[model samples]
Target: MKKTLMRPVGLPESASHPVATPLMPSVVYASDTPDALDAQYEGRVAGYTYAREGHPNADVLARRIDALEGAEGGIVTGSGMAAVTAALMGLLRAGDHVLGGDQLYGRSLRLMRDDLPRLGIATSLADPTDVDAVAAALRPETRMVLIEVVSNPTLRIADLDGIAALCAERGILLAVDNTFTTPAAIRPMERGADIVIQSVTKLLAGHSDVTLGWVAARSPEDRKRMYDFAVTTGMTASPFDCWLAERGLMTFGLRFAQAQATAERLAARLADMPGVRRVLYPTREDHPDRARAQAVLRGQGGNMLSFEIEGGRAAANAFAAGAAGVAFAPTLGDVGTTLSHPASSSHRGLTSEARAAIGVTEGFFRVSVGLEDADALAATFEAGLAAARGA
Candidate 1:
């Protein structure tokens, strides 16, 4: 597995071949005959015609991810949001209903709540942690159930296996956003998810320098439909981003392991801090979904966690102002430890009441632990907490 993910495919193994796969930025391919070009377009031959429609670099990246996720096929997208939009729009019709986790990424919720309704698609938000709640929210018109394996900001772990079983029984499509726990931690397809969504801009890209997304479908029919939608809608990723993401995937397991270790240490220390009103991490014994996380994520709580300060937004802002080393970044899964205020950032689109319903408090601060020394990060956090208390 390591060898395949780290090494580039579709290239020769000879010494003449470059150690790294060279980028093919060709927008169009040449053909000896019109019939050859027609064959390529008709899927009779393997080649590239246009960069937007399809490219060698993107194809290689998608195949690698498909193998990693144990999916029948996969495709790359311009960005994470594009992947999400394509998955929903391609799969559902006007009258179809969707049951989505209430604690999803704020922008995703906005898309479903605001845009989906305009298209005549109905959406229902429910607590994914409660299997019964999710089951109850399902209707005869429901077409899909979307949930994140580990929710953003709050780090809530849903029962992927249980949900999969329910969806299988109900004949509903199960789509999992595996961004938080990449294939390195969990393969949603193996857990019976019909579709697996990945924000390659996150851990899969590792450096935060690349913007890309991928969708893996368990069925070939779904893959073809999604690919057709992507081609028609022009939701394509640049070859450079695809190449960079492939490079990042080489060291993904290593990076994820280190970051996860630091996160575990920080979660433990944060729980004991008097300035913290609550710490929400899946691996924590007090976590609402600890058992589920253990079963699905194999005891890895992931590298992201959230904690609420004793004071509300005031303390969170003060900590952000006082923190050292950690920057206030809007995105996570970078190599450096970073902080995010969900109440004002990722979950800002949701109303205050809506945010509260999912445990996103005013004082809540989510941190993406990086590959830094755990002790140093703890010291920096301690100083920031002191400043928050003082403020």
Candidate 2:
């Protein structure tokens, strides 16, 4: 189901008319894109059938993102789930198998663990940090390798080149959720990633305002398969969401660099703070995948930085509660510093055993750096650290 464009409910800023209502599922021709419609009529049908199958704003935005990713084309979906579900549903079927990384987003994990098995498809999870473990998990019936470019909460950046190479050798499809390491930081396709799935709600939009998702295919076959699945599944982002995403993108390169710079600064300092026992930043020398991250990325490490506090989960919670200026928000990639307790929020769906296997301890706190002044954000952390120690 496509999400309604969540504009303020009371009237456009220009009018005395009542607010923009949640559009009916009824196709009200997107009011914003007149020029694209006009262009389509000129001499170029572009072989597009309808707005759901193709639209100007969505197509243009997808192409722009595709350029950044160096892919053939992109399929924009209503949510990240749509992108994932469509990718699998289009390519896999009953009796097929998947070799997936263990530290996936809770929703994706649930799809594989609870749903796929019900449909007679089998899946195996393994440690993506170890390239050999990934290869070992594959079976003859395995058709897909699903993994995040960088694992959530734990911030486990995968060895994309190795995984890609393994998949290529075996004629398997490698689908990477490029949400954390957006195209600005790393173009996974260049590192051998076959299908790059993205949650544009994050770094691409660069703000918390819009909800959108997409998948870019590195080859024409992948694009055709993805589009066929997406249109039939009836999952697509609205033109309004596409518009906001496109607007947000105008400043993406600039915002991504600023946020990441501050995040790296904070991650380094968090190491010295009393309650902070471990700081996980891709750029940090101690990070296990430092070499791989450097090899695949075009820019600095991203805005997200995870740390484990000295007192463990309790201390982490205390610090978050004590912080000022930054909000204790559940989401990332916002313009304000947002903190999340992964054990409770992003990784909540996993079984206790599964969570333990991935090292998602209660002490973990993932901080998403924003556009705030780095000094002020650092002091906010200092206060939070002091409060945790004093507690």
Candidate 3:
């Protein structure tokens, strides 16, 4: 009994496997011989010897994401930012130039404009929706052009095919951040992106419970380089988080579809509502990049939308207070609907002038539509709008 207690009984192998992938949290695996251990380390065998190097949970999650993104290979990381860092660091060297979209997520923009320069990497920003503008911004040292499928806060859809063609001709890599669109809307890789990044913490996880991210590469060599960097830097994700993300992915398609449908309904409703100066949704007729959005998103407007309230900061505050059922969180992509103030949250790092230049005004609010009744959400927004007008 003591021996059994010390060494837990293992599950006997059976013909039938678990319906759910079993969580293997063991950080280290024992090998029968030194040669076997060496084989595992050298990638000669299909087994894991260390969690930091490669583990079952991370591998499983990576493979699942690769399939979703149509990637040749992928690597999961501790957080969305970690994945971004790994991708950039692995592919770039000192003196390399990166051209990023002007409308990228605030943190992403800061990473490129602020942090990367510290490493001797040069960076520039351009309008991703305008392929020619992006081309004009490119430098001779430019190695990567990073853009998002749907620009944050304003919903500017990128011209992926045009940019990809330009990049191919110039022999530059195109990295697309697909966290907003996910695989439900469109896979950027299919449109000629060399790399695709996802913050699995968002729609892919379908829950706000875990913080995870993944980088999918169109080539195995690129995948290996990023994977090596992630492992060496200890940016690997938790086994438990990967397992949870996998479970979330099971219903991702349904969740995303419902959320997107609801967003479409809300976008139209908000456009007609009082105290709303403007509504920015990919499918909206007035969206500046509507044509590009149609081509990239394939008819789905996606689950995210942004709007500017009539009264700016004070009105926005009042609206937040009045919107009783709806939550006001700084983050996006959850099972329940939530709102975020970009000027105060995501883009706070940027100067006021800079924020306004990108159209993130004082009254701007980004909404992450979730699996909720459309009418109920509309009612909540109505309340918020009334409050905004009063303020």
Candidate 4:
């Protein structure tokens, strides 16, 4: 009963067809009849006229991810940022206002900070963890509220239910970036989110190989709106990328479980270590939002943890370099354990004041626990911490 929703649809019965969906790479379809092409343009029939508009493989992936996210329908995009831009651009006009959380991915924050204003859409950032602050930031022209389920780097858990209810009361659209806590951990749509955005490049794909994004709309109108905007804007995902993401989705359940378990163990171990200053993980007992995370994530702390090294940047660099098998990568959610520095990596574009406001200090380093053995990672951390102290 629990796994049915995530189960991939079986291949159709055929004697010659392969068991998996084939990649449709054709850029343009050949149609002799004008009526047929007209029907495709009119949305009366299901077909692909151009790769930039639609493809069979992308359609399958969208439906598969829609099933996972409990959405009415969805569309795939070229990248995560494309999905975000398309969703916001499709929904908002020149006069609309967007209320965004300060705890967001660096690029997403920058888009709202610098880009949205140039497009004539106004935006303001606030602490989404504070429901009152979000409510206070709302304006008469405010049309949307954007937030992350679990914030990047800091791992702060947003009050999704509370904020969703607030948006509903104010008749505002709630768009949730579910990249961190994917459908495996929390489905934002089920919690009253109007729209859900994900970077399939991260956990859903479960590998660093493919780059793709998706948007799932809870309502049919919203779904059609996003689909139409995607086609017109030409941000459609490549057929091959879509296929790879679906193949990767097959192991998402198992991969996410194992990774989350390892993360919980690593978070617990790091909290008591001598060279560690603090660990920010949702399910940890001492986390400020531990209770909220438990309620929202249904007791899952997710597959990531960020900790502060005692000696700041130098110690962080030394620990990462000294750790065996752990690479100092700029991204997260890799199948192998990897580390990233928020201040110098993801949040490097933000001002020092902006970075400090979000608690991303020079010492902060985030660890994305993979399928690595817990005991082995523990030993690596022990050695790395020693080096960090020495540094």
Candidate with the greatest TM-score versus the true structure? 3
Error of 2 at 349 (Å): 2.4
State the lDDT of candidate 2 residue by residue for 140-167, as single tens digits: 9999999997788888777788888999
lDDT of 3: 0.90
Better of 1 and 4 by lDDT: 4
Q: Write the per-residue lDDT of candidate 4 for residues 227-289, one digit (tens) a residue.
A: 888889889798889989999999999999999999999888888888788899988888999
In candidate 1, stretches whose alpha carbon ends up further than 4 angstroms from where it belongs are 1-15
Which segments of model 2 are wrong by more than 4 Å? Answer: 1-44, 47-50, 351-353
lDDT, candidate 2, at 130: 81
Which of the two candidates, 3 or 4, achieves a greater lDDT against the reference?
A: 3
lDDT of 1 by residue, 105-170 (tens): 777898898999999999998888889999999999999999998888788888788899999999
How do all models score by TM-score?
A: 0.94, 0.86, 0.97, 0.94
- The CA lDDT of each predicted structure is 0.87, 0.81, 0.90, 0.88
RMSD of 4: 7.3
Q: Clashes in each model (backbone N, CA, C under 3 Å)?
A: 0, 3, 0, 0
The parts of candidate 4 lying over 4 Å away from their true place are: 1-16
Model 2 earns a TM-score of: 0.86
